[model samples]
Target: MKRKLSILLALVMILSLALPMMAGAETVSLAYKNGSLHLRKGPGTNYGSNGYVRDGDYITVLSKGSVWSKIETSAGRIGYIKNLYISGNGANYADGTSYFGGSYTGYVVTKYSGSSVNLRAGASTSTASMGQLRNGTKIKILGENGNWYLIETASGTQGYMSKTYIKSSAGSSSSSATQYATVTGSVVNVRAGAGTQYVVKTALTRGTTVKVLEKTTSNWWKIQWGSYTGYMSANYLRMK
Candidate 1:
């Protein structure tokens, strides 16, 4: 009985130390407005998407994990989102910086030939496998969840790739040449600047391809669609 009591006390101590960081009533706002951050049903991208939360929408953080946070929206909805997609209070990343979006390009790599990496339909290793990607197969990393990356293949396949076997396509994928991407959301606004307070320049429909120029300090992609050059949220653009 004494031994069990000691163990219980130790567990309580651990919880006491850890709970403050995870549970709080502090208010925060969604950060990555590339368009809107997907509100998830659970802690990771393996969970179903509840919907989307736009940038600057204030939320009450119910709990926080290293990679995900549970929040209550101003509308009183509860959902999960990546920690980097939030800011204001109690928002932080493992690297000590708040960065959202997995907009870079990546590729599958392995030590041996013929060994393919599994791309899962969700973020977990236990999730259903969509397909396998061979070594050197290029992928567009759109977002992240724990140890997996939400990726889209050239043939329009979307899935999760383990970060262990995938690496960023570093050198040849540099920003020198012209880049292009398609808008994923329905009718995303091309703004004069990065935030919602900025004037809306125009609206780009889904499947419309635009020339990517650069990302603003606030993370909006400066794009050129037709003759109009303006900024759009990074969330809505699929970096192709």
Candidate 2:
């Protein structure tokens, strides 16, 4: 009877220690004062835009890169958000685990005046205007173009607004290295070989960020990401 009791107590102690280890996993939240956010390809602003994320959204921090957090949206969309945008408001695990979040960091308009902006599909320029943006609204710019800018409105709408309407907001500057690289405006086919005649492996999702390893010519670039690497069209990749 004494041996059985000792065995039972030992098993209970082991389970207690194991339980906490399993419970250490957690989710994170996304919040900011400016109310606007950008989702990038790989956690830093250097990558191109995958989509726009708003304040109060919950994103799962899957992994951490130097200053960035690889997060997943409620819709299962995976992308990277700056550590400055995460609010780490939840309780920390007793196992010495913690996370991070950020206050609102502002963005700036990157172009001068008189730049033409194209309204994207599903965006209405008439009723869904870019927050009273006229030819010049002195707005906060999120991205740049040779002729336009991606801007955020006071009301949280993100669209291509003419750069001619806005100037750099106060305190909205970054290092030259932090400046965004232009992603190709067109979708390119992901192929199995380095030539156009190669077999089609798959169609890369629009807004996917790819690393250009080598430029075969003006039209093709050797690219790689994750476990897949091959030649893709230069017309599809933006310079970063």
State which candidate has the highest lDDT: 1
Query: What are the runs in model 1 whose C-alpha is more than 4 Å off?
Result: 1-91, 94-104, 107-171
Clashes of 2: 12
**lDDT for each residue of candidate 2 in 14-81, tens digit (9 for 90 to 100):** 99976643443333322212245678987566888888776556666778776788877766678887
What lDDT is reached at residue 68 by model 1? 82
Candidate no. 2 TM-score = 0.27
TM-score against truth, every candidate: 0.38, 0.27
Q: What is the lDDT of candidate 1?
A: 0.69
Give me the candidate number with maximum TM-score.
Answer: 1
Q: Deviation in angstroms for 53 in model 1?
A: 21
Q: List runs of model 2 lying over 4 Å from the truth.
A: 1-34, 90-240
